[model samples]
Target: MKADVIDAEHASRVTKVDSLLPEIPVLNADDVQLVGDPELITVSVGDSAGSGLATCRSVPEDSPRSSWQALTEHRLELKLAGPEPVAAISALLDQWEVHLANVARKSDIETAAVIARPSRDTIGSAELLQHGFAPVVGIAVRPAERLATTGPVTTPGVRIRPAELGDLPTAVHLQLELQRYDAQFGMTTMRAGAEEMVTEELRAQLSGEPTMWIAELYGQPLGMVRVQLPDQAFWISSCVNAARVGYLSSLAVAEPARSSGVGTALANHAHQVLEEAGAEVMLLHHALASPQSTPFWYAQGYRPLWTFWQRRPAVR
Candidate 1:
């Protein structure tokens, strides 16, 4: 068989999942074809009722390699619309595993793996890894203005300047360090192949689309920030309301540089950049429970405009 594909529209039971979880979107089986066989079947449960779709694609049984490799190598995504959908989809995935095992055994295929997105309740890496999956990666947002006057005050040093290609590596390293600091609070870890990703991101920044700035002390990189102009629908919405917002995507201070005003200096620099770019406000997202940042942001004038919660089975 070229490939066994099952889509939302084709399966009655799949429709039931969509009905239960309207927020989730059904998968388009065609998109699954990008992965070559022996491929792991990608099953996505979206958070939508009639609006959402759940999809699954099975690899060819007679393929030369193991199915586990196929599943692990490709990106598999699953979204549960709500609490009810999460429970339902979890059960559904278990049922699919049984079905897959039977088919693999009959076709003389050994070593099959199925990876799904963890429910919001997913606890630790051990649990996710046990299920042959990784924890979901989440994006963190923080208001640019929050860092304005929060944290320890430091004497202003060098004036903020536009970042050059020569600063890309340093800026990238700063972002990675901040990410590492974030992982302490159960946030997504940026380790493992992150260096290459950061390098590519820096290259993109250098090419255009966003402006990057760095704050230096005594000729060394102390802190940095990046501001991207409004380009997407959400950004446009923010702008139409004259949100005049700037985003503080990445801000960091070396351990030795802390409490010396590096962060404040950087935020001040970002504010200037945003004002010049016509931004009257700035937006950022940070973990609610973060010790070093949450209070700092609060002190600077950024308040919680939204919240996100996650839960997973206590067992795994």
Candidate 2:
């Protein structure tokens, strides 16, 4: 089943969560598909009170995407367009939980995750928080011009250059260090074999899509930054299509290199590189729980554009 109306065409009962949002949350049931049993993914919106669609996908322990939410494996995507959206969506979520229980044991699915794409309005953001949705991941963006600037950490013996195949070992180590830092804030659990995962992911990223740049001080690899050209998948806000977006996938600085301005240097270098590539905007995601992330990104001219709220409930 799908939402009775597509694109919230007649969602009189629901109001826009963010008026400045580029597009309305019009994802119908057909908007997504799951990897598990087809029977596990069900939709229901036939004349439903809410104009929004509700869908759930159960993630197995081995799922690559499931690593972020260590305690919960259930993912939920929701958007209700109609009058009394909060109340309507609340009820729909309750029903979805029951649906999951019927098909799978509650133990396999502990939490519900939802990605709330960026928007200008606070209604949806606020409502989700009120309903136990905690802001775990944040999408931040800024223009390329604002990011282009004089080097912030230009000191004797500090250099930034493109990453090469030879830098994989240091690159992978830095990436793991970043994950460790984020884990301190509960951004993700330190799962077994995470190092192997990062090694594989970095090797592929270094070889393809993302352009990796390393920061060295006295020939010792202290940090690195990964940048990517705009890929539609990361741009959840359809309205953001007008400009070429350069994505900052990750930035890693060793503990010994933190205060020496290595991060800023890497950031400025990335800005210059992306600008040369004709990028108009820069985007990245961070966790709100990290004290270091909040101030650092803002200082670099990035502001919160979207929030991914999550919830975890015991077996129903």
Candidate 3:
């Protein structure tokens, strides 16, 4: 079935399943469809929707894009829900495996991912693991109201300031360093021309939004973070129930500054800035396996809202 044609009963059932995880907003069925037109599979029992899955295929190599798009050439994002979600997911994967082997070009599609909830981590464990998928990343959220009222938490001798066009070199270098580090974990890829793409992307953000911030320690730039306020965060704001949301796009600390409180200062500053800008909640993504980020974000009061289980080179 086409995503747009999902019936009300199915949508309602999906929402019911989602209610199990109150932290995540119930995505409207209409908005569940990904960028490319997606195909959906509906599991039914006696005329009632028992489960559903929607798959969207994405090909980022078709056009010039941001360096972040280097992760995969062809990708598949799966949206699933149901009462017996595990069984339904297993069946869907079974069918997809066949389709991948018979019709799809195995070498072209690089990743297949499912956006799931941390609350349901064990629900489909066997199925997801059997299919070679691993929980790789998490989308974490923090309430902005509390932070807004809280006093600033700054490290001594560290100063945070808005990034300017003149800081382009430092910003780009830090971002690329982050990309390269993350690439080691497979979530990010440093493709040919990635440096140019990252430079261009950072240049635009620096010159336009005034949303990025740099952390300085004794006059040396050591950390940077890009946060988009509610207005600028509309792209992902709808994913949560908060009427006003903020996004922590990227946060990086130089190797020399690791564990020196630079990251903490940068993040604390982001909370203060975003909250002051009227953000009711803030969200960010982090690689689940990252030793540096997991504990840091948790300490900042962020918890996983959605976990992405992914398998690279889909066919595998």
Q: Which scores better on lDDT, 2 or 3?
A: 3
Report the Cα lDDT for residue 120, model 2.
Answer: 42
TM-score of 2: 0.75
Candidate 3 residues 103-219, lDDT tens each?
A: 344555344444454433555667878988788777788887562465577798899999999888999899889888876665576667777777887888877867899999989
1 versus 2: better lDDT goes to:
2
Which residue pairs collide, candidate 2?
Answer: 13-82, 13-83, 14-82, 14-83, 18-121, 52-80, 52-81
Report how far off residue 282 is in candidate 3 (Å).
Answer: 0.5
Instruction: For model 3, give the 10-residue run with minimal summed lDDT.
Output: 62-71
TM-score against truth, every candidate: 0.51, 0.75, 0.82
> Judged by TM-score, which candidate is best?
3
Candidate 1 residues 70-138, lDDT tens each?
221222233333224444345444544454444333322122233332122242234334444433222
Winning model by lDDT:
3
**Global lDDT scores for all candidate models:** 0.47, 0.63, 0.67
Question: Which portions of model 3 show Cα errors greater than 4 Å?
Answer: 1-37, 44-56, 62-66, 69-83, 108-122, 147-150
- lDDT for 202 in candidate 1 is 74
